[model samples]
Target: MGDYASQHSFRIAIVGGGISGLYCALAIHHHCTKAAVSFKVDVYEQAPEFKEIGAGIGLRPDAAQLIHNVGLGDGLTAIAGGSGDMLYRRFDDGGEIVTVPLSREGSVKLAPCARSELLELLKGGIESRGAATLHTGKACQRVEGLGDSVRIHFTDSTTADADLLIGSDGIHSQVRRQFVSDNATFSGFIAYRGVVPMKSLPQWPLPSYSVAWLAKHRHFLVFSISSNEALNIVAFVTKEESQVVHTKESWTSTCSRGEVFKDFEGFHPSVQDVIKLMPEEVSRWRINDHEPLDRWHYLDGKVVLLGDAAHAMTPHLGAGGSVGIADG
Candidate 1:
């Protein structure tokens, strides 16, 4: 047996219990068990409880297949909504642009699901496998390398040591800051997102397929989630970098419906109607991404980065979450 195989027990500490963190835990457990290695994983989150902030995410076929390969296929199938071609149209005249099929013959279908629901599914997978111990309300303040092991210092003044530390935290990752000198850069884009009940849009024109309305410097995307009971709408607008007021506060904020309406003024009536149907307030998110790093691990691979912490990108293709899942 190799030296690693002969080790008595391997300890892993995962910072941030979001989708990437939890999914990484499951992946580690799956691989360790297959290799007949004894391991323990600890997942730490800054939130008081496990919750996802986003509305919905569309997982590409490969990401869905990754979940299936990780043994959560049944759980994902239960919560996943339908998938088909993505229809594109012009925002002004509502002219059809093109239809892009998300899946080819014999390929797995796209999986659109609520972010919260996907988190629940991943948490359930962790629970069923007894893969990791979840720690909430424990924010990571910093990390220290101890040559042979890594020590994590939390905001509560507590500490934990593990053989390996994985940072799956989102874009503003504390772990990444510990080693990498660079930070996330604003992508010159902002997105306003909301969910509207399907029942409210009785005269909805498009089919159930995901749709995008294109225009100069902006686009609107809509797709069914929660079993087609609700539509997730995202309005993306390009903004001058100087117009953005970047802060340490939460990246997501609520904006008045008037602001959204003003942004989409002169759009087609169908697009305007959908905007009107949205709630009085919606979430505005400033999109940010990072330049590719020369490496994802440090301290001889004892410390590593995953998901957005490693490679954050604009959600133009709805591949961000799926990329995170693949990182796991």
Candidate 2:
């Protein structure tokens, strides 16, 4: 912010190319173009190609508004699904316990979008504007602050320098380590997630509304995505923190359908029916979150953290992605 008006160009380096990273890149371009500030953005991703590794993501009203403000309203509307009430039901008998409205009158309703679709929208936004240079397969190994600039060293022995560095990397962020001492801790919760074709569940009685079948130590969330063509299912179970031997490397793995059934035994028959329709191989995720840090920036504002890298909480509220969008 210091005398950028006189500068011919400003450089930004983003260490990750996930949802927040791509959205941050697009937002920067939108603002800089409006303020007449010339800037260059470079995004480095560790994966061989840009891809989102999840099923569905919920965009709260505020996050949807931010995307609209960033000039991607049309694209968002194209991919976003209708809003619905969230019904909580007893797991044993499937009796309704409560209904929570997910949309407020005169406000943008909560949007259900496939994670991959949203990622594509963000990538298309950047591509349409030609706003930033994207480098794939370049994992950030470490970072060094050089007075007025930051230098990023990647695993491939490549390096890049920029006036500022932003870390939109997910929960396991390399840049966040430069400042914070604490790492992401296992939340003692594991989730089995997968999508089932609606055609397979023709007898599915639930409406298009989001549903949460709850029990003492477990819960199963079911919502429609992909224009109601599929049902996105996430079944969570609590286990002793010490009992589960997991690492970041084993954060996500594929498990057999029987594993999910064993954890969710004795659930309502309707719930079991939905579970039976899940793909033979379901994704097992070891849920993790951070113990909020006192600070998220370093090198006197030259480096910053956003999204899950900044505050990775449980997905109970479905605000993780939305909050990350706001962080941008």
Per-residue lDDT tens digits of candidate 2, residues 1-328? Answer: 4455247479999989998899999999999899988899999999999898668887888999999998887778777765578889999898989988777777766777888989999998999889899999999989998887889999999899888899988899999987777888889888888877767885757654488999988999988777767678888889787755742324267778998899999999988898888878778888898998788889999999999999999988889899989988
Shift in Å, residue 80, candidate 2 = 2.3
lDDT of 1 by residue, 204-294 (tens): 6776448888889888888888777778888899988786674222435777789888988888888898888987877788888789888
Residue pairs with backbone overlap in model 2: none
**Local distance difference test values of all predictions, in order:** 0.85, 0.85
Q: Alpha-carbon error at 270 in model 1, in Å?
A: 1.6
